[model samples]
Target: AQSVTQPDIHITVSEGASLELRCNYSYGATPYLFWYVQSPGQGLQLLLKYFSGDTLVQGIKGFEAEFKRSQSSFNLRKPSVHWSDAAEYFCAVGVGRSQGNLIFGKGTKLSVKP
Candidate 1:
């Protein structure tokens, strides 16, 4: 079965510290991948996506991810994390060609310290 796994359920990072959130996927073929952020009481917001293109994809809010086919990983990284970045981050994969067919990871909650 295809799935997305976010190893960390919760992470705490000091303000201005570098951050990296891991995401791994299992699928038969190269699948469409995405990273989404959801704030408290807010809906999910797209941070970035990877389909068929360069290995490195840039995203909104100074975020970026690299698609590693060999490793089956698409990890999200940021040079510095802000308190505003504290939220829940989800890693997802399109199960089918259709955009609606997606399987999302449990999600990782990020907490920023002062």
Candidate 2:
């Protein structure tokens, strides 16, 4: 079965420091890549996504992700980290054509240090 993996269960970064959250997917064909952030008691907010055209996709909140077919990775990156960025980040792959056919990773918890 196709799945997504976030190697780091949790990560800590100092304020104003750079951040990179890794995401890898295992699928026979090219899959839709997505990154979402969920704050405490809040719904998931889309950070970025990669469909077809661009290898590097920009998202809201200064987040970006690069899709590397060779590595089967769609890692999310931010030049600087903010205290409010503390949340659970999820990397997902669309298993099917439908948007609902998403398989999410266990998620990586981000902690912003002061």
Candidate 3:
């Protein structure tokens, strides 16, 4: 079984400040990690994904995540955040060779202050 945990329920950051969101996963085999963001009333958008190769993977919207196998963590980072970046971010783990159903964590809502 694969599961993801996002410890932070919410985060508030000033616009232009750096941000980082933590994510942890538990899986029997090597897992596929993804970060998705959703606006107030919109569908989720894939931010980034880590399947293999380089531990660090870049994502859309100036986001990036590093897969730390030692810690079982795939944390998202942004050097500078914009007001538009405010949204609910979810960490998901997908199992199997094929793109399997994802087990998502409780989302971390980001609030941007001007």
Candidate 4:
């Protein structure tokens, strides 16, 4: 079975400061890692994913993540955040099952300061 753990349940970052969210996973084989962001009363938008190739992957809104195989960690980072970026961010692992639904972490709520 595959599973994910997000150390931080929530986070708050200033409007222009950098941000980082930690994620760790456990799976039998290499799993597809993804990061998604959800705003108030909105659906989740894919931030990024790691299927193969380079360990580091980039996503929308100036976000990026580095996949560390040894540590089984995929952490999301952004150089600078905006007030509009305030929302709940979820880290998920996609399993290669018939259903494509993702197993998501608890989610980290980002509060950008003005």
TM-score of 4: 0.94
Task: For candidate 4, give the lDDT of residue 69.
Answer: 92
lDDT of 3 by residue, 70-108 (tens): 999999999999999999999999977786789999999
Residues 20-94 of candidate 1: C-alpha lDDT, one tens digit per residue: 999999999879999999999999999999999899999999999999999999999999999899999999999
For model 4 the local lDDT of residue 82 reads 92
Q: Report residue 38 deviation for candidate 4 (angstroms).
A: 0.6
Per-model TM against the reference: 0.97, 0.97, 0.97, 0.94
- Candidate 1, position 77, lDDT: 96
For model 1, what is the C-alpha lDDT against the true structure?
Answer: 0.96
RMSD of each: 0.9, 0.9, 0.9, 1.2
Q: Lowest lDDT 10-mer window, candidate 4?
A: 94-103
| N/CA/C clash count, model 3 | 0
Could you give candidate 2's per-residue lDDT for residues 10-114 as a string of tens digits?
Answer: 999999999999999999987998999999999999898888998999999999999999999999999999999999999999987864688999999999999
For residues 30-109, write the lDDT of model 4, one tens digit per residue: 78999999999999999999999999999998999999999999999999999999999999998885568688988989
lDDT of each: 0.96, 0.95, 0.96, 0.91
Q: Assess candidate 3 and give its lDDT.
A: 0.96
